[model samples]
Target: MSTLKNEVTAYLGNSSRIAEDWANYINHQDWTLEETIENLRQMNADEDVMVQVLMLDTMQGISTKSSEKTPDDYTVKYDGYYALNKMLSTFGNSENGSDVCITNSFTNYINGILSIGFAVKVQVTGVDGAREERERNG
Candidate 1:
């Protein structure tokens, strides 16, 4: 394995499994606007948290240059960005579960103060490697 891969595995205990678990966890959650906003201030420098953010960025196509993302991927990426900016100013939790809103800051840290000190770099594959790996053992 390459140095980057070895380092990532050492810290994350298996990037593929961490990503799969994250995808499963994220898939089942009802990410409310209030909850997502609150979680942003909870960001930590833990390895697992860093890996989780890496996985999310992979899915959102921020760290990669692939064009294979589904239409929904585009929607989620755009929505997550929108939520980061728009949700903070809005009042009331009335729009928690609304489809028209962006409700996940877990993936929105790209638009926040995410630091380079927590790097867990992975190579960009030609395919939609992020989503494909999740589906393999999801």
Candidate 2:
């Protein structure tokens, strides 16, 4: 990628400003470049990343979930941050910054120890294909 374009894409990652810019850019008479299009597509992809996880046992499927406060240590496996945040909204009502990401590869421990049932793989997508895809490549 060109330095200028890459820098632009990096700066505009998933930002609403990108949408505005695209709206204006697409309106212009000039034809858009393919590289820019692809870059924009990548920037808006499912950027759901993982937190500190050690082991991941994959069967097949993508499930979304978060753990309730339990007597034992709570682990969270989430599909997307939006879904996870929505589920966690009522439970703890505690303050947690965005860095606390959960992934499907492994079980995630909650901040405190509690009696959690620990249900895994509640994928909003219906199929836990993302986990299977990652596991297959590795």
Candidate 3:
């Protein structure tokens, strides 16, 4: 059990790092769906993993609605973070040739999350294409 816990911790750490890296990479660039897909591929990530992360991130925004004034709120937030961490574990293992669909889904998901006013300051910058996609579709 201890070993498993340690493994999980390590995995989470790695995922967090990757997420941060991706966020930073897109911080100043105009990201298109194709460009985002290319960046993920450069990171050795698979399509499914990319889609999963996008989905989890979208969900995380929704989960933030819990009042942070209570301990339960913290717990909920932790669980959402954990789910994102778990999704990161599947990165780089998804099937190829689905980047287009995955990118579209990711854009739609992000837009939906934004529409709820849940991720105003959580924008993934530097992806111009992604921003355009969201604007066009939203």
CA lDDT, every model vs. true structure = 0.30, 0.28, 0.33
Candidate 1 lDDT, tens digit per residue, 1-138? 699988965754443444444334444544432232223224323432322222232233232111243422311232344544243224122333211221233333323333222212222222432321111111
Instruction: Judging by TM-score against the true structure, name the best candidate.
Output: 3
Of the pair 1 and 3, which is ahead by TM-score? 3
Q: Against the hidden reference, what TM-scores do the models get?
A: 0.25, 0.16, 0.37
In candidate 2, position 41 carries an lDDT of 46
In lDDT terms, how accurate is model 2? Answer: 0.28
lDDT of 3 by residue, 39-122 (tens): 545664533232222322333212212232442431122134443334332332334311211111122232123221111111
Candidate 2 on 13-61: residue-level lDDT in tens?
Answer: 5332434344333333232222223333444444432111111231222
- Give the TM-score (vs. native) of candidate 2: 0.16
Residue pairs with clashing backbones, model 1: none
Model 3 stretches astray by more than 4 angstroms? 45-138
Shift in Å, residue 64, candidate 2: 24
**Of models 1 and 2, which has the larger lDDT?**
1
